[model samples]
Target: MEKERREKEEREEKERREKEGREKKKGERARRKRNREWRKRERKKGERERKIKEKKRERKKGERERERRKRERRERRKKGEREDREKEERREKGEREERERRERERERKEKERCDEGERERDRERRKRERKRGERKKAEREREESEIGEREREKGERERKIKERKKGERERERRERERRKKKEERREKGEREERERRQRGERENGREREKQ
Candidate 1:
């Protein structure tokens, strides 16, 4: 009986151990399935986070590109304004130089006209002086000619008066000589007549006494 009881006890023990081992294997399979499900969830969450980070980085890069384009446009506008201002200044300077040249030309022309007027006045004064000198010379020559003519007339009158006085003196001398000759001839003829009368009377007396 002891031996049979012992064999029975051993079979029961073996059965119990076999049942415990099966239960333990079933729990281990349940634990391994839970772990696989949790790992799958974690992997899906990591993929979602990486996609969000990549989208944020792309948006930041686009903003940087827009800022760079804006700066370039501003610089180009400033350069264009500077070029326009320089062109305007050059145009103003050229106009100022042209005005100065025109003013100088006008002044030169005015000076030339004034000099010509002075020369013309000098020529007129000289011509007037020559005419005055010629008139004075003509007057002096006429006066000299008149004086010479008067002197010739006075000389002719004196010569005529001297010739008339000489003729009157010769006629008076001839009249005195003729009167003396007539008086002498009358006295001689009267003396001769008286002598003839005396001789005739003496002859008559002598004849009477004789008778």
Candidate 2:
């Protein structure tokens, strides 16, 4: 009887030890699962930090490029301003040169006009002198011709007076010869008549004696 009871107690003790070992193994498996889940969460956090850093670096590079482009634009504007200044200076010089040329041309034209006026005045004086000399010669010729005509008229009047005096003397001599002839004829006729009358008286006395 005592050996059976001791054997039964040992068997019961062996079964309790086997059940405790199974419980320890299940606890160990649960711990291993929790560790694995924690490691996965840590890996996700690290990946997110790396992406944020890369985005910040890209933004910085874009800002630097924009600054460089602005500087280039400012340098180009300065060069254009210098070129414009040079062009303005050249235009002013050209305008001054044109003004000087126009002034010189006007002066030359004035000088030419003055010289031509002087030449015309000299020619007018020469023509006036020639006309005065021609008028003097014509007046002298007219005076000589009038004097010769007066002398010719005086000689013709003297010749006509001499012819009239000779005609008057011839007419007086013819009248005196006719008067002497008429007086001689009248005296002869009177003597003949007186002789005839005496004869007739002698005849009358003879008749008375006869009766």
Candidate 3:
């Protein structure tokens, strides 16, 4: 009977130990499962953080690229403006030279007219000297008086005709100058319109880029 009791106690102790071992195994399994789940959650969080950081980096890089392009465009525009200014200066110099040439031509024309008048006076003096002689002088003087009167009438007619022609020519020249001015103004307006349109197009492109 004591042996039976000892055997029963041993069996019960063995069973309890086995059950404790199973419970310990279950606890270990639960701990491992919890650790795996925590690791998975951490991994997902880390992945999400990495993606956000990557997106931020990409955005920063893009911004930097955009800024670089903007700076380059600005530099190009400044160079173009400087070139245009130089061209304008050259054009002004050419115009000044042209005006000076026209003024010199006008002076030469006036000097030629004065020289022609002096030559006509010298011819008239030589003719008067040749006629200054003898008994024919009285008859020559009478004829001279008649010729001078006829010449005076002719000169008055020529002067009147010249004044009328000059008036007409002056009006024509004024009209031509006015027409040229109007044409130049129209061309300038067209160019200004084109520049404005180009500016507007550039503004639209910039807005689209921003969008």
Candidate 4:
């Protein structure tokens, strides 16, 4: 009986060890499966987060490109407006300069015309004055010639009268020689009368020349 009891206790211990080993093996296999499923879910979640980040980055890049294009367009518009304004100003300046040049030319032409007119008037006045002077000189010369001719004729007539009177006095003296004293006294008185007549005639001639 002691040996039989000892074999039965050994067999029971062996059965208990085998049962505990089987339970441990079953728990280990379950834990391994749970770990594998957790790893797979984590991988899927990581992939989804990566895709979301990529989409956000693409949207931000598009916004930046659009902003750059808008800035370029605004700058181009401002430049075009500035250029147009400058061109207009240049055109206006050219027109103003042309107007001023035309005005100056007109003033110059007017001044030339006025100067020409004044010169023409001066020439006409000088010509008239010269003609008047020539006419007066011709008149004066003609009057002097006429006066000289009249004086020469008067001198010749007086010389002829003196010669006739001398011939008459010589004839009278010869006829009265017989009446001596009376004849001499008559001759002296006649000579005195003749001298007085000659002096009066000279005085009359001098008065005429002065007049």
Candidate 5:
């Protein structure tokens, strides 16, 4: 009975040791699994934070680029305005010069007209002096002079007619050129307005895209 009890006690002790060893191994496996899960969670969180940080940096960079581009556009627009003003000033200067030249040309033409009138007066006085001679000789002289005068008058009339035609054609050409300039100005204005509208639409599209 003592030997049987001792054997039974020894078996119980061995069983208890084996059960404790198995529970310790199970606990180690659970700890390893929890460590792996914690490492995976930490890795995922780091990745998420890195991605969010990168995205924020990228967004900030994009905003800076956009602002820089906007500033450049504004500067370019200001430069264009300055250039336009310079061009306008140049055009006005050219117009003033043109007016001065036209006035000078008109004064020269008046002087020429006065000289021609004086020449005509001298010719008439010579004709009157010739009329004071003998009757038949005077009549012959008058006929020849009248014939010459008629030729001169015909040539003057033809010259005047040619001048009139040239003036009319020049007036017509100037009118056409003026009309073309006006049309070009109108077209340019329309194009500018259209470009503005297109830019507005593009801005709206970009806003919608961002949203």
Candidate 6:
């Protein structure tokens, strides 16, 4: 009996020891799994931080480029303004010179006009003098024509005096003939008067018949 009890006790002790060993191995495995998971999480956090830093660097570079571009644009605008001002100044100067030239041309034209007017006045005076001289010559010619007409009248009177006797005989014959013509013209006039009186009497008879 005592030997059986000792063997059994020994067997129980061995089983207890084996169970403890199995539990220690399970705890160690769980600890190693937790450590691996923690390391993975730390690696992920480091990657996120690196990405954020890179993004910030890119944004800073973009901002600096934008500033540089803006500065260059401003400088170009100022330069363009300066060029425009210079062009305007040059245009104004050219305009002033043109005005001066125009003034000089106008003055010269005015002087030429005055000189031409004086010359025209002299020419008009010369024309007027020539017209006066021509008029005087025409009057003298008309007076000479009048004097010749009077001399012709005197010659005609002297010719008449030389032919007075013969003219008297011809005059007697012409007077006899003129008296016969006058008697015939008087008879014709009396016949015309009688015809007019007959026409008036016929017109009155017609008027009486109508009435």
User: TM-score: which candidate is best?
Assistant: 3
Model 3, 1-211: lDDT tens digits are 9999999999999999978866775687578669767976996698689769967986897688669757875786577568757865786597568757865775676567768776577557545644553235466556756875687578658856976787689669868976996798689769966986786588557656744
- The lDDT of each candidate is 0.59, 0.58, 0.71, 0.68, 0.72, 0.71
Order the numbered candidates by lDDT, best leading: 5, 3, 6, 4, 1, 2
- Which pairs clash in model 5? none
lDDT of 4 by residue, 6-66 (tens): 9999999988987786677567757855875787689669868976996698679757856
Worst 10 residues of 2 by lDDT: 162-171
Reference-based lDDT, residue 98, model 4: 74
Model 2 C-alpha lDDT per residue in residues 14-125, reported as the tens digit of each score: 7777667656645764675576567657755765686588568657865775576567656655665566567556755775676568557755655677676765764575
| Estimated TM-score for each candidate | 0.39, 0.36, 0.49, 0.44, 0.46, 0.41
Kindly list the per-residue Cα lDDT of model 5 for residues 4-117, writing each as its tens digit. 999999999999997886677568757866976797699669868976996798689768866975787578657756875786578669756875786677567666776877
* Residue 184 lDDT, candidate 4, scale 0-100: 70
Question: After superposition, which runs of candidate 5 have C-alpha atoms over 4 Å from their true positions?
Answer: 1-3, 108-211
Of the pair 2 and 5, which is ahead by lDDT? 5
In terms of TM-score, which candidate is stronger, 2 or 3?
A: 3
Off by over 4 Å in 2: 1-15, 83-211
Candidate 6 lDDT: 0.71
Error of 4 at 199 (Å): 99
